[model samples]
Target chain A: MAQVRNKQVLLKNYVIGFPKESDMEIVEGSITLKVPEGSSDVVLLKNLYLSCDPYMRLLMYKDTPVSLGFHYSPGSPLTAFGVSKVVESGDPNYKKDDLVWGVTKWEEYSLVPSAQILFKIDHTDVPLSYYTGILGMPGITAYGGFFELGCPKKGEKVFVSAASGAVGQLVGQFAKLTGCYVVGSAGSQEKVDILKNKLGFDEAFNYKEESNLDAALKRYFPEGIDIYFENVGGKTLDAVLLNMRSHGRIPVCGMISQYNLSQAEGVTNMAYLIYKEIKMQGFIVSQFYPLYPKFLEFILPHIREGKIAYVEDIVEGLESGPAALVGLFSGQNFGKKVLAIAPQ
Target chain B: MAQVRNKQVLLKNYVIGFPKESDMEIVEGSITLKVPEGSSDVVLLKNLYLSCDPYMRLLMYKDTPVSLGFHYSPGSPLTAFGVSKVVESGDPNYKKDDLVWGVTKWEEYSLVPSAQILFKIDHTDVPLSYYTGILGMPGITAYGGFFELGCPKKGEKVFVSAASGAVGQLVGQFAKLTGCYVVGSAGSQEKVDILKNKLGFDEAFNYKEESNLDAALKRYFPEGIDIYFENVGGKTLDAVLLNMRSHGRIPVCGMISQYNLSQAEGVTNMAYLIYKEIKMQGFIVSQFYPLYPKFLEFILPHIREGKIAYVEDIVEGLESGPAALVGLFSGQNFGKKVLAIAPQ
Candidate 1:
């Protein structure tokens, strides 16, 4: 059979400090739609959307010393969670036209050798793009970190840094669902409003406007914070440490604020951790993959029923991908930023 | 019978910065050995050795927030862990000549109103002074922190800061017993030798002598540290963070280095915690008091068999108590500094 071809975006080199558009380039490449003769375990897909995550910044570095997720190699296409339709299949489980979501190459199409990590998108009744954002890795991250690590109790004070971001938004909502008093901090007023008015957070503040985060937290959480979902590190972490109640738990997901800095800001108030008996645990979403199905089972219903809201800033075309990904560190992108590579 | 007199050491005022010898003054006061006619739960004892710990530095500050332990009041005797013999008892559980260990006033004699947190020392075969040092709060801290928080494995590289102090010494030994390659850092050459020779550590270095702590840690832990028992925070923590192996665990017991400073030192390398997926938990020993029996069950045998050894720099007489306790911040004590107010 004549083979159909696809295009891909490849990283140019390892990035240092903040990632620039020059670090990544959309290279013209071709992939066969069908498996070669005698190959029995392969599938080809047309990717519709790709997730832009903060963790991707780590992957752009030359050597990150083996972190939670798999590292991306320089000169290879960046990998991320994406929604795709299988165009051809040699695997027994998947068939042509089956929609799936999982880690895939940053491209319009890919020929996957194995589909072990892939999950078929069964609930198309909800937004198809949800598979790349709220119903995927970010969704599972919020559930696992808040419920499993944070251990929220009703009426307890919950504080979230980067509350307007993908995982942070879900975390705030989850805290609200658990009947906890939730407060969140964002970089701008729009995000603060979304947290308080749209996401149902008890209070929200623009950390940029607040001169003193410690005093701001004291005002928002007068009694002190019981749970802190740490998304932004540096000064925010130091302030949160001081505001933590006795036996407080902090589930560290990401530190967007310090990701791009050559010398990350130092946290000075860590002594509070000992006095408060704080338990701060850093976790990767991949560690909780077994719970993904259970997480989808729990979150999809709320998303479908419109009880849970997810916001995404969609950047069109593969050429714009680099800027979209870099926007996360600068706080320029609102909500879950994603690149829509192809039209439905 | 005439009432047994209660002798007390009173704090004259709130100390500023480093405590001076004149800051704490011992005063003699008398209390009836017998409980009041209506009281049902009181005990009297003759205090032996009072534990001199770095945390006591916080107690001298007048306006510090209330914590799980008692706060020192101006013009009142300071209180800490002490090994004592019951001279009289009103509580049915305690009797004359019973050896006990608990938080007690720094004095020759104490009239304990309630024996709530006190433990009866059954293992008298070992040195009674152990109750104030290795076999007491410091021992339990090392045991719980290294075992529970660190979750060390054989062949793992363990790094301990303030390695010759009361807690750090035991942590090094405990890590060695678990078959881990342990390295430690102390302020002086004497303490470093004690760590390497007496505490069974594989390597030891004086942090004060090293020009760069990161380079020092790299020299000791070539493969990177799997566990860091953080006692001296500030620059040491920053260095350890840089050299931490992936999935490293840091059990923060105390930050002696930053305790005396007007402002805490900023830790610049905390971003490594996220990149390495490290788990840093700060714990207070009082939280694990319920595990005392289990701790004693495991540790007593080790002590009696001489499998574990302890060091104490004892200062005789109550007059030297203030200087001894204050000397800890300056690293003046050679071993687990203790004050011998009265001999058993």
Candidate 2:
């Protein structure tokens, strides 16, 4: 085993509002990569690629009554999806050099006590880095949230917000594959282009440029939106509520626009949800973990046949990790933001 | 049959804000209550017990898209739930002396075609007056919304807003019967007492006196709310969102608090819905009409067995109808506000 060394990122303090760059700091110390001699069940892993997601911004806040996952405590490395290679195994099921995708620290290596949360990656035909995003949590999120929650049908008018982001991009592609009319809204013109020309969305709009989001939706969805995959919640959600068809379904995967705010903006047009009898559900990707194998079965064939496409904004090295993580909140990254720690 | 006369209540014009006494005026004219000569399936009857729901306040505004059911033309009688015996029947299923509950004109009588939206009151052991409130649409709303949408489990904490009102009162009773720890909020102390002492709620509070709604909810629901039957929206909903437990469900039956306002109030704590993975569904009673028979079968036995109790604020005559209906918006009525047109 390598000499015990721990390179960790710690939260300085609980964030009051929006998280600033200074809120998190990376520190270095030492620890053994292998479990101690007395320990019966502990595996050490070298994290290869880490996922930077918008929901992490929420963890910086102090204790709250509501949270889907564990709160990030001050002076602790943030929890996120990572691709790691098992170096030492305490469990009989895992062996050395077994690649896995699961929760890990935002550092070089981690000693995971229980291997229950980890899933062994079996498909080597695709890039291992895909486990950090497109083929991992976000991938299953798009698959389960859209098909299971959104219940998209062929010819339905589907609208996605934060269109070119990790989950939204995949949702648009999946909707298109199902023969639905899909439109998406993104922050930049470049993203709008990627949504339309590359991701195969029927239409795409730059929400930053549109003065009236409701009008933009009406123009794109003349008949009205049958399914809304809610990623950005606030004014965009209010607008989508007004343009939703009767019996429309909204799968609330994430609300990036409202996460960092001390008080989330009020949605004025939510009454439309009642008037149109809309079914809006908020779901965490973790709830569908049991479906991960099924998700892979559905997605892998598409990838091999070249029917599905995925994009990533890879930032190299551990030094650039903080900036890459924070870039997601500012909409600075072009696609799925990933940090590459080591080569396969 | 009596000579056909159409008595109608017309909107004086679009109401600017909250509807007032002067916003609607009643007018009378002659029309045939009998079905037209060549009509294949049309039934005409004397209208009775016009229900005044908060949603009607939205229809008073011009071009607001407020009518979720059907549009009302200028100078037309307002449409709502009413019980009436068929005076003339063109459809095969309906005939004279057969009482029905459905959309009817806000006047002395109405000419309804096909009886498609109407449901016959098969069980008359309960008060026929209940067809307008407890045993009718509001009853089905409370039943279907609580069981199907909210999915309340045994011993779960359930919260109902507008507790003393028509739909809310039943929801509280339904929760109590299901072995839930039910808490309710009302606008007045008297209503609160009825909720606790008379209606058998585990806890009840007058929201008007509570300085902090979130604190009030926390005090009443120490373990947090498992089901929130949302009838009154705005700040009440905001407070409920903050106190909801993980996997909480909110059935958006009505937003009585925001119905009369020209612009709806924004709920500030909506992000809690996402953080808690709450399932908030907005549904219409009309959508659950098909389940009414099953609902009555479930509820009537409860009523007969004395497991459920209800309260109604009855207005004696048609002249007091407008005020009785509008009383719901102001939280002036002690319980289900019903205008008694005729005794069964």
Candidate 3:
């Protein structure tokens, strides 16, 4: 096996508040293009499209008190979900040249345990990058949070925060497919338009344009919201609390707004939970991994038939990985943030 | 039919902040001892023991934006749950001389709709006043929120706030009976003693005495709480959020601490719900009313065997009703606050 220069994105230091491009460094590292001999269940992968998710920011912190099992050392390559081509496999299930999507480092080529790979990308009819957005973690996240946790009913008033982003866009479309009247809040007019016009959201608003989120919710949902797919959290969650109907359900997917803050915003309207008999539940998409097969079956047809739509803010090269990941916090990316490390 | 003088506790006005004895006035009114002719579903009740409940405070507010249906007009007698004797009945379910427990007025005699009465008090071996505490609305509230919502498993760690109050005490006992390791938080040393010594809770603490509730929770629940029966919300809820285990359940029965505040304290630790994948649900006892027959069957044996215990702070006369109701907010009463308006 020949030694090759591997381009990698390494965490420069533990991120304190909001993550920045400077917090991650692009460097050259050397690795043999082969898995070690007798290394059972190991797979050699050439990383392709890497997911730039909000949860990745949590890994940038040193010894994150809140545990999701992914932590980055000061000089280690940043880890993420990506579409990869298997170069070699010690696992019997995967063969060389098989396409896969799962947990992999932000590097040109690296060896990973087979268990880290979620699934073999069998259906390659859609774009390979869709695996990082519509067919992978974010896809499962929206499916699990919206259908499993939310339990939305037809004609129900549903509100989604960060409604133009990766999981949010899918959730909005799912709600609509379920016959729910969906409303979404986004940061920009362009994102708002994508949510309403492109994603089929019944209503969409630019949260930045509204001074009072509570008033905006009331304006959109006069009868009160029956379900809220929470992504942004903080003040938006606070406002949503006030406008929730009796027996309302809040499926907290991600708190993207609070993740970067040293002190998360205080939610004051919690008493409404008691007043309205609300069910506010938080869930991680990994908990719903068992349902992924069923989810894919349900979503793949929609994607192929052009019934469901996905948007990707694709940045090319492993060098742009740091900037693309950081851009999520600032709302610089339009939809599913992805970094194209290599051509498929 | 002869008319009798009925002593009534009337709301003086819509309560703004914390309810005071002055907010309610004891007035004398007259009602005939007989049911009016051609009155369908009407029952004349000779009120016995009246329950002093936290939800009553919510009703005292004029045109409460949050609808629980019970409302108080300044000139009318305040309505509540009370053990009453059926003086006369026009409904088949309730008959003259039958004892019952349900929604009644804060007066000596009340002519009410038969539908308002919850159930006929069948078991007479126990004290009639038990219907106002251990055998009434508070009883089923503890049953539903704990067993149905909390779903505590054997050996699970359970925490109850306002542990000496009507619902909290019963919840603590039920959790213990379910083979859970239970801890309770009360307002005073007396209530704490009642929770630990009398109610068989594994541990008890006086929340008022502990300045740092989070530290106190950490001290008691080192492994973290599996279930928190939320009664007094605000700061206590904030502390509990920090000390909850992954997949913890919080059944929010009441927010007594928040009810009095013009601006309820902001719960800054709500993000814990997402981090820990917690389910925080709020519910009204009324939603679980249909399960009352099954509840009584479950609880009656425990009562007869002396396996369960309840403490009641009984105040004599309708004149003391105002003070007894106000005492709840101040944590003045030692146990379940009940006003003995008329002798059994």
At residue A215, give the lDDT of candidate 1.
Answer: 99
User: What is the Cα-based lDDT of residue B239 in candidate 2?
Assistant: 88
Looking at model 1, the pairs that clash are: none
The local distance difference test score of model 3 is 0.91
What is residue B243's positional error in candidate 2, in angstroms? 0.7
lDDT of each: 0.84, 0.83, 0.91
Q: Could you tell me every candidate's TM-score relative to the true structure? A: 0.95, 0.97, 0.98
Best-performing candidate as measured by DockQ: 3
Candidate that beats the other on DockQ, 1 or 3, i.e. the better one: 3
Steric clashes per prediction: 0, 4, 0
lDDT tens digits by residue: candidate 3, B138-191: 999999999999989999999999999999999999998999999999988888
Off by over 4 Å in 3: B63-65
Give the top-scoring candidate (TM-score). Answer: 3
lDDT of 2 at B73: 60
lDDT, candidate 1, B136-174, per-residue tens: 889889999999999999999999988888998889888
Candidate 2, residue A296: lDDT: 92
User: Could you tell me how far off, in angstroms, the CA of residue A183 lies in candidate 1 after the best superposition?
Assistant: 0.9
Instruction: Locate the minimum summed-lDDT window of 10 residues in model 2 chain B.
Output: B64-73
